[model samples]
Structures are given as structure tokens and as C-alpha cells.
Target: MSDTRPTPIRPRPRNDARVVTEAAELGTVLGIWAHPDDEAFLSAGLMAAARDAGNRVVCVTATLGEHGTDDPRHWPPERLAAVRGHEVAASLAALGVSEHHILGITDGTCAEQPPDGVVRRLARIVSDVAPDTIVTFGPDGFTGHEDHQTVSRWATAARATAAPRARLLYATTTAEFAGWWEPTRHTFPVFLTDELPLRTPRSALAVELSLDDARLDRKMVALRAQATQITGLIAALGEERAREWWSSETFVAAEYAESRSSWATWQVAA
Candidate 1:
């Protein structure tokens, strides 16, 4: 479903204080994702925005994306983990995110067993950081990946026990409508706003960040720093096309519990 019609663009509001205050400025933000580049896609803008506001941002990726890609001649599983790990570190550095950790979970194997230990590991991180906010995939795991769902489960359980006061949010996607970039059919409306019904929790608060080409380029550069996967494709696409692919970061706050009396960025239950 594409909108072929042209529409006028309205300017975004310019209340600096309002914008600053409205953006959730949590004391610490812990982003738990299923794979290496998952956080780079969904949370980079928010993380950059958070860091700009002086908040600590930590990322705990569940796996190294060792199962990514099909180039047998290029990347075997044994090499993929270390290569992607370095790429993750580089990407994090580019995005100004300092705290990065990986859980060493086997990629594509999250569904084969119970996740008690995963839950414990997540809880331990929660206990240590005690983040004011915890961000991860929604129950549908964004793309319904078992690893993502398992990670979400473990994150929520950890939030419940170790950091009851921490607000929980989910990173989501525009996947269903992410198909409008067909170069031959690149109508602006259809290409940009043919959004899908975001499949995260219905009550999740939607957050959108609009960026200029420069900011988008910065983000793409951060993403491109992950040479293990995106490098070849991004180089093929060129910067403008790459920017189209990387612009307008979106998210949803799936489980933020407002604390009773605090004016915190994310209100966590006591």
C-alpha cells in the first residue's frame, strides 16, 4: 500500500526546553538486543540523544550475530563472532556509547532450551546497572525471532526482580512497510510514510526522531563502522541511498511503569 500523492510538510515544533524535557533523560539506559547490529538500527539515535544529555548508555547484546550472512567463502561461524564483536565495539564507539557487553549466547539457538540462566544473567546486569530504563525487543521480538522473544522475556524478568524501579521499553521496527524503497517506484510518500501497524505492545508510546541528511549520515557512518555485515551493501547503495535506508529512527516504549511521585525521565515502580 503506497501513497502516490504529494503532501505538504509541516515544520516540527521548536520549543527547546519542551523538547529537552519531553525526551526521556533516564539516569542510565540499558539496551538489550538479540544480535550485534540490532541496537545500532533502532536505538542509536535515542542513545546519541541520551548521551548528548549526559546519561550513561549501556548495551547488552545477546549474541554476536554469528549466524548472519550466507557468504560461505567469506565468513564462517568461528570467525563471525570475533569479527562482529569488533564491529560492534567500533559502532558503539562511533555512536558515543561506551558500555557494551555481549552475553555469548549461541545465535539461532534461543528456542532449543529453557532460559532460566539467561534470566539470571540479565537480572545480574540489571542489578549492577540498576538502570532507570531498560530497552529491548517487544514480545513479538520485532520480527518474531525466538532469540528476540527469549531476550525480551529475560529482560522483563530481570526488571521485575532486580530493578523493579526501572522503566522498560521495547525497540520496534517499520519492517512491513520498509519495502517502499523500490528504486523504480520511489514515490516520496509511499517510500517514506507507508508505515505498517507497528506490532509491539499496543500501549507502547511511540517515539520518532527526524534527522537531516547530515545527522542521518552520521548515523550511517556509525552503522557502516560495522564492517562485518553492512559494509558491502552500504557501499553499493551510495551515501544518499544509504541515508534513505538509515534515516528517521523510530521506537516504542512497551512497558514503562510510571513511579508514583517522581518526575524522573522514566518512572519506574518502587
Candidate 2:
């Protein structure tokens, strides 16, 4: 097959947000995430918009999120894994994303896996995709999930090792989102953590997309597809609040991520 690599991503003008409805701003996009609903909660709309724009959008999920529950008795690992695998398919379909990779790393075990092996495998995928933009988690891992952290490290190293020219972005909450969700911070945990999350202020955001009515509806549908994971949270937060919670997608560029001294290092080789 002929190489279809896109042009490297250039810096966008400050204070200007790319209309998600437009194509080429993000180029062919590759998303690397930790669990089944990570992509849905973070970048589903972005992925769908890119696909609609005719860009190649590939998704890589690290685990099935088998332990993503409050009741292990009713939701055992094996059973949850099977169900989540199917749910992810439906979820991705709702977003119009057809290319997906499920790296079968066991749930809750990524931090223990040998980094070199994981990075090598991810590097292979990066080399194959040749995406102009790569999106994943930052240092805080969104909700400080160990799996999210490990995946972030692997994805970053892989990008450095195999596709350094690609633009890198980390999914992050904006200050607005932090404020909007502050009231229920303890009542409703969006991801795996109960701690206050790190946010990227609006001024520093590279790409922030507030889904329009149509896109927000699509995102809700995609998120709802993972009923086993999101149903209860939606019920507790109420539909409107739940919708408002994820209606916007925010990401910071690699330079911003690197600027944080605590999250500074990027592995040069797998």
C-alpha cells in the first residue's frame, strides 16, 4: 500500500478553535486510551468529527475495564470483560469510528507490565498509523488511574520512538469543566478517582471542542452504549448534568504537557 501519512501539525493561531465540523485541522487522528469508556468520555466527539471530515481515525484501547464497577459480586472480571468488549464496539460504531485496536493487557495491571515491551508494541502501531495527531492522557491520567498513567507513558514513548513528527495532545479538563463539575465532585466520580483533577486553563488549550447539539447527542449515545460503566453515573448525576459534564472536549499540546516539571520526561526508546 502507498504511504498516506499526513503533513505534520502546525501551531494554530491562539484563541482560535478549530470547528470540529471542518477537516484537516487535526489531520489523520490516532487516539490511545486506557479503558473502554476513556475514549467516549474524552474524545468520542473529536473522533467522530474527524471521521466525518474524511480523515483516518484509529483508536487504541489498552484494556477492557473489567473491574470498572462498585460491585464485584454482580460484575465479575470475566463477565465484565466480555460485555465491555461488545460495548466498545457499539460505542465506536456510534461515533462512526471503524478502526480499533484492543491491546489485551489485563485490567489494573499496566503499571506492573514491563515498560519496554509495551512501548515497543505501541511504537509499532504508531509507525503503522503515521497519524498527524496523537491524543491520549497527560500526567494526572485524567483521574489518576494507574492504567491511564501507564498507557500515557507508553503512548508518549512510542510517539517519540516511532513518530516524533506527529503532534501530541493529552486529554484534559478545562477550568470551566472543573467548575461545572465541582458541586458534584464527591457525588459523582467521572473516572476512576475521587481526587480533584488537574485542569488546563482555556488560555493554554490547543484544541477545545464544545460539541454542538447534534454532536453532543451523538456523544451521549456513544457513552450510553457502555451501559455497564456509565449508566449509574448518569442516573446519579441526572441526564442533563451528565450531558453537560462531557459535552466539551479539551486537550493540551505536548509542549504544554512538557512544561510541567513533574511530567517532563519522555522516553526516547522502547
| Number of clashes recorded per candidate | 0, 0
lDDT per residue, candidate 2, 1-270, as tens digits?
Answer: 544332222345565554233434899899999899999999988988888888999999998988787788898889999999999999999989989999998888888799999899999999999999999998667776778877988999999999999989888776677778778766665445433355555666687887888988999999999999888888888898878888888887866652332321222111
On residues 1-270, what C-alpha lDDT tens digit does candidate 1 reach at each position?
554332211222343112122234656889999888888777777777677678889999988888776674578777888989988898888778988878887888765546787788888988888798888876556554667767777888888989987867766545432553444334322112222224223233345566666556657767887887777766766766767766665555443321122111111111
lDDT of 2: 0.80
Report lDDT per candidate: 0.66, 0.80
TM-score of 1: 0.73
State residue 96's C-alpha deviation in candidate 1, in Å.
1.4
